[model samples]
Target: MVKDECKTLLDALNKVSACYRHLVICVGGTSDSQNLREELKKTRQKAQVLASANKNKLTTILKDKTISKDDRAEFERLWVLFSTCMEILEIDMRRALDLGQEFPLNVPTKHLIQTGMIGRTSAVAARAISVQNMKYEEGNDIDTIDLNELEQDISEVGEMIFEMEMKVNVLQWTVEAKQEPGTELKSTVSAGASSLGMISVHGDGNKKLCDTNKVFAGAMFSAVLIFAIVLAVCIVKFA
Candidate 1:
């Protein structure tokens, strides 16, 4: 029963991580600078909210006072994945910003952005897996799970989340930088001035954000399905 619960939680964490990666990729592909900026902002805000909620949930689970060692170990693994994902997202955002600087135009910019995003996402996933393996080495018995270890895991997760939040803010600055006036501003004072460019930039950003949403939604659904299956098994065993 304990193993089943751990599996369910692990599956959920994996799904969430996958969804985050998809979102980053989608945002990176955006052509419209304005739309990209807005989407990135929204994603960053959502991640912040989710991280806080997850921390609360972890605290509650730990404080249950009756949780078995195996369960605690499982929760630790989940926390590691959660923290690692946030860190990777931040790294990807930073790379995206760097890429954004390299390509002020539309097409070439997205390719560079996607490359950086994908690389960071993979790195994050690998880190999460490594943490999970490390956590497992501590033993599977609930009585053996030490409070000090749990606290360490919690602290690490918090640091990763905070780092990601900071990086997201930095990314926002990059987006704002693109909004500044350029050579076109000096060429003409026409009403349409840079209006077309603005529209194109925004349109690209929206499309990318939408694509990310779709990928994340699908991954979340799959995770839910996995969680449901695990829950069913637990119910059957414990009931």
Candidate 2:
């Protein structure tokens, strides 16, 4: 009976290994990006199904008081393999997605240049207007700002904001997983170690995740508000 569960997990890991090989082919530029993302979506769904169906049963086997020590050790060994393979699958998916990369798009060079020019021009105009309103003299200026440098800074901040948002989403999932009893092992299988998997199945972890998400929300809101204000000012000035 214990061997049966181990076999199930091993089969799941084998499927993931096959999926990972296909993912590598997609990531190697032989396949289009859309196909790559689609494959990942499908893989995630399969993982969710596999975990949902088997996770509780596997846990039951391990936590049974009458389970033999040898069986327990074998199950643990297979569990580790399954967990590590799932983690690797998730990492490769994220890499293919370029989770924190700028733009995450394949826009044409011409369009990108045109957009950058317009934004840079509008930003400079907005800055000039603000400086003028502040009554800064030509000879004794308060500060000089470079539009290119400012744009780069804003882009970096935006990327950081996006990364924070992703982490917050993972934290929320972890908290919810803790709140549900049967979902603990399933969540670990589906979300990998960096997300719902590594989180403790404890109420304290749930509370801590919630608190951290709240703090992240407040900080993210402030940053997004500031960016929105700047963007609005540029739009108004340009218009």
Candidate 3:
């Protein structure tokens, strides 16, 4: 909800500013700039109001004596994140206005990429993964980093991996369903070593290469998918 307030307000201002820029420069006129300026002012006011409400909510969450330690920690973390984002948004707004910089229509990441308080993908920055100074760690007396979400994610993934491996083994066994219980799944081994099989397979080197390529591709895909999912969870949790 806090992220929505910050991002939606910034996005509105950005879009309107971009349109105003295009109209005044690309279309060679300032006809739309006046209305866009008014809209920007209104959006700024709305954003400020929402920001105040967000802070009040955070303050209430923090001061509630009945709240558990865990919940309080979460709320405190949220306050830090929200405050950092607002700080960046305000500073960036000032910078833009001072320089008369035209904002692009494309919305920035909801995770507040500008403040560098949250990690981001390689596409947005030079690093593949940038560790954020979460919970106002850079300025706070306490710097205890929380890894609970990461651990929970790993546990869930471990369960999924076990299930997937069991399914694979089941598939291997099902392939020989009609064979005797003690029979080995050696059909391919026997076939490849037989004289008839040798004759048919002697000239099919490309097929083996293609099969190897597919296995390599599948492994790469699985590795990337796991990495991406884990990275996303980290971003979401710390944001």
lDDT of each: 0.50, 0.47, 0.42
- Of the candidates shown, which would achieve the greatest lDDT relative to the real structure? 1
Q: Indicate the residue-level lDDT of 134 in model 1.
A: 21
Among the numbered candidates, top TM-score falls to 2
Off by over 4 Å in 3: 1-32, 101-239
Which tens-of-lDDT digit does each residue in 1-239 have in candidate 3? 64455445444434433332322231111221223333333333444445555555555555568977656555554554554445544543454353223332222334222332222221221121122411122332211111232233334434433443443222222232234654585676676579667776865876888899999999999999999999999999999
- Which run of 10 residues does model 2 get worst, by summed lDDT? 113-122
Per residue, candidate 1 scores C-alpha lDDT tens digits across 1-239 of 54455445545554545544454454434332433333333344344455556655655665566888666655555555555655665565554454444444334553644443322232333332332322222223322122233244445555756654443322222222213467567656554767878888999999999999999999999999999999999999999
The TM-score measured for candidate 1 stands at 0.36
Ranking by TM-score: 2, 1, 3
Candidate 2: TM-score?
0.38
Model 1 weakest lDDT span, ten residues long: 135-144
Model 3: how far residue 177 lies from native, Å: 47
* Candidate 1 steric clashes: 4
Off by over 4 Å in 1: 1-30, 101-239
TM-scores for all predictions: 0.36, 0.38, 0.32
